[model samples]
Target: MSQAAADTMDNTHAAEHGGHHGEHHVLPYTVYFAVYGSLLVLTGITVLVSFAGLGKWSIPVAMAVAVVKASLVVGYFMHLKYDDRLNSLILVVTLLFILIFFAMTFSDMRTRGMIDPVEDNMVLRNEQAAEKAAAAEASGESSEKGEEAHHEGAAEH
Candidate 1:
């Protein structure tokens, strides 16, 4: 084998194995600081929003901010931005499945009460109490007396 041919084979082998001798990308200190600053700002926003009395909207808003922060960290700090496209695609697909799972779980939880006989019974009890109050008012009777009589009847059992 010729010396030049051997050298060419070595180069080809190195290239095939993913040449680590190639130039690497290095992020500047400013970039790191910017990402850190952005994360801090998002944390502050999360705290502020918690105190803003958003009620039911707070959890979703905070989760959204957290997702943005996580993306920034993964893309820049974790070097996924400079990584192979396949890895990025895998991450996206994994996130999509996780989101779908959460959606399905939440849907199941939200609909559980609708199918529960205990919940239906509670609703029926509230309606019956309201009707009883209306009937008592029409008969010029106090609800307190009705409640007392009901309690006494219950105590006999």
Candidate 2:
């Protein structure tokens, strides 16, 4: 083949196959509007939840709504839905690690009192005793200096 024909063929191949290599813009105008609308609705729900005074449920509800909104933004606006499989896998793995970390933290919190309840109290008492000792030392040093001053005054008289 001529060099010109080869160049044209290469360009055509790139045009066809390059979609997967970069961010693919797939959704149209109406889809973008819908995504934005859903995001706004989620925001409103979060705000309403904040006002509802459900106590503990408030945080869970707000968090759930926020997660949904984040998923929408990630899958649509950020083009994660059209992203490469490796990128999707990385996101999933990252989320899994975060969940594992949270799970471990909660596990520790749940079992904290079971191991030895005295440890916590001992820590508090030790802190209090250290403070008391420091205060007493300061007061004793001041009183000794005052007495020494009195003795010097008596000697001068």
Q: Tell me, by lDDT, which candidate is best.
A: 1
The sequence of per-residue lDDT tens digits that candidate 2 reaches over residues 65-108 is 99999999997788666556567889999999999999999998
Q: Give the clashing pairs for model 2.
A: none
lDDT of 1: 0.77
Using TM-score as the measure, the top candidate is: 2
* Per-residue lDDT over 1-157 for candidate 1, one digit per residue giving the tens place of the 0 to 100 score: 2553454455445544665356354555666777899999999999999999999999999999999999989976886665555678899999899999999999989866645375555555677888977888799887788889889989998
Ten residues in sequence with the least summed lDDT for candidate 2: 1-10
Where is model 1 poorest over a 10-residue stretch in terms of lDDT? Answer: 1-10
Candidate 1: which stretches are off by over 4 Å? 1-23, 116-157
Candidate 2 vs. true structure, TM-score: 0.59
TM-score for each of the candidates: 0.58, 0.59
